[model samples]
Target: MRTQVAIIGGGPSGLLLSQLLYTKGIDSVVLERRSRDYVLSRIRAGVLETGFVDLMKQAGVADRMEREGFVHDGTQIAFDGEMFRIDFKKLIGKTVMVYGQTEVTRDLYDARDAAGGTVLHECSAVNPRDLDTDAPYVTFLKDGQVHRLDCDFVAGCDGFHGPSRQAIPTDIRREYERTYPFGWLGILSETPPVDDELIYANSERGFALCSMRNDNLSRYYIQCDLSDTPDDWTDDAFWDELKRRIPDEAADKLVTGPSIEKSIAPLRSFVCEPMRWGRLFLAGDAAHIVPPTGAKGLNTAASDIHYLFEGFDRHYNDGDSDALDRYSEKALARIWKTQRFSWWMTTQLHRFPDQTEFDLKVQQAELAFLRDNEAAQKALAESYTGMPY
Candidate 1:
């Protein structure tokens, strides 16, 4: 089989790129290693950045999101028992939508199916070949047979553990990574959220987050040792820890219930430089990763797709190659900025294992400044809402 672009991932980033390309009459095929149901089963972040929302609109897939997603004008932050709000709308005229990543993926899949886009699921041993040459293709196993897909270019949106990143030769690839000393123990419950907006709390006990999928579903998290697992905590214990971290008032009103989903995710900040390797381009987790503290994971991936989509659109529609040539330089610029923000958020909210009294004091002062100073709040709002495209 032959296509203009052979995309090696059917995740949201790759699907979004394919859908966006389709808007301009570009042709592509998405290859996914897992079944559709498996992809949908993976729970992820629920916040959407303004830039990501714009891309969904451009792809003509924002109907359900607009109808069901809640618009959050700001988020609340807490330290000890005290809490303050940073108004993204009031400070910067911007707002975020509370929409789950799973929902976004589902919407994209529906749009792709309606458009008759090719998305091959359960594709095993998928590999991008001849990446350094102008003619690139992907090979994979299906139905006990080997298949090859020829294409003008390949998109490696297969994620961190996927073969796409390893395909980039070691000599040409450079990676930066920092694994946190702790992880986030999270639970999803069928209950009303503690507040209308999300709350990020830094307590003497640990770091915690209060978020929601809708009025009836609440998601909460608390910092835990890296070695801990979901089986280690019971439903009631998780609720108690979460309540201890947030403000007393909010916790008083917090509704508890049986956890439908529970998991522990270790925090990490990672980036692979030069997101491009000849005819093969990387996007999403294949190129970068950030701590979940600031909820930048999926949004950063969307930004990569934005740049990749623009490059493809220009190459196919406008006879322009400038954007394609500068894809890496441009994407990394924004990626690093996001990395810094996520790092800042993680450091300010979590207790480090080796942190001294001075470090704890500094963290407290940082939160205090963010709460008391409008300038600091404005800066937080700007980064939180997202910088420019």
Candidate 2:
């Protein structure tokens, strides 16, 4: 089989890229190693940056999101028993939407199916071959048979552990990574949120975040040991810890319930440089990863897709290869900025294992400045709502 672009992943990044290219009259095939149901069942961040929302609209999959997603104008930050709100709309005339990644994937899948796009699920041993040459192909096993897909270019959207990044020769690939000493113990409950907007709290005990999918489904998280497991805490215990980390007033009104889903995810900041290797290009987690504190995981991936799509569109429609040539430079410039923001937010909100009294005081002062100074709040709001794409 032959296509203009062979996408090696069925996640949001791959699906979004495929749908976008299809709208432009480009043909591509998406290969996934897992079932469609399995992909949609994984719970992820619901906060959507403005750029990502616009990309969804451009891909013609924003009907459901516009109808169901909630618009958040601002967010709350709590520390030392005091809470303050940073208004994104007031600061920058912009806002973010609360829409789950699962819903976004579902919408893209529906659009792809309606357009008769090719998406193969449960294909194993997918590998990219001849990435350094003009004629590249991808091979995989399906139904006990090996198949090859030839394409002009290959898109690696299979994520951090996927094969696409590894395809780049070690001699050419450069990686930067920083793993946090803690993890986030998160839970989903069928209850109303403690506040209308998301609350990021830093307390004496630890850090906690109050977020939600909708009015009836609340998602909460608290800092935990890197070695901690979901089995270490019960529903009631998780609730208690979350309450302690937020302001007393918000905790007083917090609703408690049984958790429907629970997990512990370690935090890390990672980036692989030079996203493009000859005819092969990497997008999303295949090329970079950011700590979830600033909610940049999927949004950064969307930014990569934006740059990649622009490169492809220019190359095919106008016979311009400049965008493709600068794809890595442009994408990496933005990825590093996002990494700094995520790292800063994580450091400010969480308690480091080696945190001293002076460090605690400095963190408190920083939060105080953010609350009292307009400049600081605006800076935070700008990064939170996302920088220009």
Tens digit per residue, CA lDDT, model 2, 1-389: 99999999999999999999998999999999999999999999999999999999999999999999999999999999989999999999999999999999999999999999999999999999998888999999999999999999999999999999999999999999999999999999999999999999999899999999999999999999988899999998999898889999999999999999999999999999889998999999999988899899999999999999999999998999999999999999999999999999999999998999999999999999999999999999898888898
Candidate 1 lDDT, tens digit per residue, 1-389? Answer: 99999998888999999999999999999999999999999999989999999999999999999999999999999996988999999999999999999999999999999999999999999988888887888999988899999999999999999999999999999999999999999999999999999999999998999999999999999999988999999999998888888899999999999999999999999999989989989999999999998889999999999999999999989999899999999999999999999999999999888999999999999999999999999999888888787
The TM-score that candidate 1 achieves is 0.99
Instruction: Give residue 381's error in model 2 in angstroms.
Output: 1.1
Question: Which portions of model 1 miss their true places by more than 4 Å?
Answer: none
lDDT of each: 0.94, 0.95
lDDT of candidate 2 at residue 53, scale 0 to 100: 95
Q: Pairing residues by index, what is the TM-score of model 2?
A: 0.99
Worst 10 residues of 2 by lDDT: 380-389
Per-model TM-score on C-alpha atoms: 0.99, 0.99
Return the top candidate by lDDT: 2
The CA lDDT at 151 in model 1 is 96
Q: Which ten residues in a row have the lowest lDDT in candidate 1?
A: 380-389
